[model samples]
Target: MPVTEPIRVGRDTKEELRRLKVHPRETYDDVIRRLIDVYRKCQQ
Candidate 1:
């Protein structure tokens, strides 16, 4: 398994991420990747 490091976020920030998730079970990595894809599409 790949090593993972802990990341810290403020309470409000964490809440925002929870709301942004497509599904309750989605990981933070998935949410971030999806946001990046949307941003790249907008930039084009």
Candidate 2:
């Protein structure tokens, strides 16, 4: 089994991630992964 870790973020940062979500129920992990992919594409 994979180990999961807890992370803490500021309320404002959480709100920002909420806004970045593609769907209402999208997880923060998905949102950050999508953002990282986009950034990597731009850097290439």
Candidate 3:
């Protein structure tokens, strides 16, 4: 398992995620990791 840290995120992003049903149990770091990975793939 990866070590996770708490991050303060924007309310709009949080609300959007809830609306999209992205499993609220996930840590913010997980969400960031997925987003960054996607961005990295897009850059390739």
Candidate 4:
């Protein structure tokens, strides 16, 4: 099994994550992972 962790964010940041979702059913983890992938590509 994989271990999970929690992190805190401001209300505005939470709202921004929701807005970035590709679909209503998408998970925040997916959104964050996608953002991380983009950031990695940009740094290359």
The prediction achieving the highest lDDT against the true structure is 4
- Model 1 lDDT tens row, 1-44: 86777899999988988999989999887897899999999999
Residue 23, candidate 1: C-alpha displacement in angstroms: 1.1
Query: Which candidate has the highest TM-score of all?
Result: 4
Per-residue lDDT of candidate 3, residues 1-44 (tens digit):
77756767699987765554468687556666787888999999
Q: Write the per-residue lDDT of candidate 2 for residues 1-44, one digit (tens) a residue.
A: 75767899999999999999989999898898899999999999
lDDT tens string, model 4, 1-44?
76678989899999999999999999888999999999999999
RMSD per candidate (Å) reads: 1.3, 1.5, 2.7, 1.3
Off by over 4 Å in 3: 1-6, 19-21
Q: What is the TM-score of each predicted model, taking all chains together?
A: 0.77, 0.82, 0.57, 0.88
How displaced is residue 1 in candidate 2, in Å? 7.4
lDDT of 2 at 41: 100
lDDT of 3 at 12: 98
Better of 2 and 3 by TM-score: 2
Q: In candidate 2, which residue pairs clash?
A: none
Weakest 10 consecutive residues, lDDT, candidate 2? 1-10
lDDT of every predicted structure (CA atoms): 0.90, 0.93, 0.71, 0.95
